[model samples]
Target: MSKILVTGGLGFIGSHTVVELQKEGFEVVIIDNLSNSSINVLDGITAITGKKPIFEKLDLREKSAVQEFFKTHNDVKGVIHFAASKAVGESVENPLLYYENNINTLVYVLQELNKLKEANFIFSSSCTVYGQADELPITENAPVKPAESPYGNTKQIGEEIIKDTCKVSAQLNAIALRYFNPVGSHESALIGELPIGVPQNLVPFITQTAIGLREQLSVFGDDYPTEDGTCIRDYIHVVDLAKAHVVALQRLLAHKNETNFEVFNLGTGTGSSVLEVIKSFERVSGETLNYKIAPRRAGDVIAAYAHTEKANKVLGWKSDLTLDDAMASAWKWEKHIREQ
Candidate 1:
């Protein structure tokens, strides 16, 4: 069995992708520093998948350590790069950290992959690259507006880095999935988003407030131009987003890529307002969340969702979960974690 390397495979989306990769019969090895994530995620993965993957707690930011890893595991056929600091507000407070963690580590991973006879790379990208597209249902070809925050800037730059590398190296093939918003957990309730400190994303905050971890949920703003005057975003299930990575990796490994570099927008093609999301949670969890509208944050966009035509036709993937489903699973996982 050919082995695949998943950086930050213990984190939220990475852990789900690791589970999907294992199910596809691909030998998997995971490298994580356990900075924002914990080692207990491995037990959750094993409990659901009935197998444990090879794991190394290595920091990818160290160029020397990354090269040593590739030398030690020369059989690694592919790389899924997901390890990075990913909070928009946090990035604004510390842009240097975002640049170092996101950009520097990407360069190191690509350098190691360029040495192999052939390599397949999947990049964890974000929809913030579109930056409030002028057109509704942002397509892959939508102009990448200036990133609103340092975290988004890293993704935009990372895509460009991969594209430029693929142009020069015939042995390197890469795909970047511009994820909109990944929420929810695996249906088994084993692993889910467990952010350290206060949660930045909406779903986690909602769950925490419902479970009494927090006093209230701040809706960010109610003045955005929308039905309910709140920002709207496409919220795809994390498991669905993880499956897209596997499909993308398989496309590169099978030599089916039409180009050395490709980009796809991974989302459900449906946009939901923040108020709508809270209502869905109320319906699913049967709790009216205590939320108040604060002033708009600096980096938030009014709306962004995927067109999904290219991803569906080219990548043969589409999200299959709803906001209600996501809210239910998230509520279940919150209870599970709190009960422990």
Candidate 2:
């Protein structure tokens, strides 16, 4: 089995991807600085996969450390880079942090990968790059709008960096997966979205509020011109999102990518509004959530789903989980963690 490297493997999405990789018989090595994640997540992954990956607590921002890591792990055949800081509100507050953590770390990783005989890279990208799309089901052809925040800019810049690098470096094959909202946890309720501070994403917030960790959930807006006034987004299960990473990596390793650099959107084609999500959560958890409609948040898109033809036809990957399934798993995870 080829040795695969997963940066930020202890994170919510990364951990699930690591499990999927291991299940596919890939030997995995994980690198995490533990900035936004915890050491406990490593245990959750081990419990689910029954394989303890080699873990290094190193920050990618340090160029020397990154260089040393690649040298030490020279056997690594594939690299899934997911170590960037990923909070929209915080990025707006401190643009420098986002640039340093997101851009600089990406540059360091690519520099080392370029030195390898053959490098297969999977970049953790977000839908933020598309911003508020002009069309309803956004596709790979959707013109990337101006990034509304530094966090989004980092993703856009990161894709451009990979695209440019791949144009010249025939040895480097990279895929940037622009994923929409990722929610839920593993079926075992072992690993899930457990952010350190107050959760910024909706699923975590709903789970926490139901668990009594939060007073109430706040729907950002109810005035958007959608079926429901609230903003709409494509929320895919974390497990489904994680599986796509493995599939993308295999495409690169198998030399199946038409271009050295490729971009794919990982999302369910269906859109769910805030109120719809709440109703789903209530239906699944049997707990009526306390929520209020606040002012429309800045930089929020009216609605954003995906046109899944590319990912489905090309990558042979499609999200099978439903919004209700995600909510059920998330609620189970929240209860499991709180009871302990």
Taking all chains together, each candidate's TM-score versus the true structure is 0.99, 0.99
Separately for all candidates shown, the number of backbone clashes (residues 3 or more apart, or on different chains) is 0, 0
Measured by TM-score, how close is model 1 to the native structure? 0.99
Please state the error at residue 319 of candidate 1 in Å. 1.0
Compute the lDDT for candidate 2.
0.94
Over 185-209, each residue of candidate 1 has an lDDT whose tens digit, in order, gives 9999999998999999999999999
Instruction: Give candidate 2's error at residue 302 in angstroms.
Output: 0.7
Q: Once model 2 is optimally superposed onto the true structure by TM-score, how far is the C-alpha of residue 262 displaced, in angstroms?
A: 0.7
Q: Give each model's whole-structure lDDT.
A: 0.94, 0.94
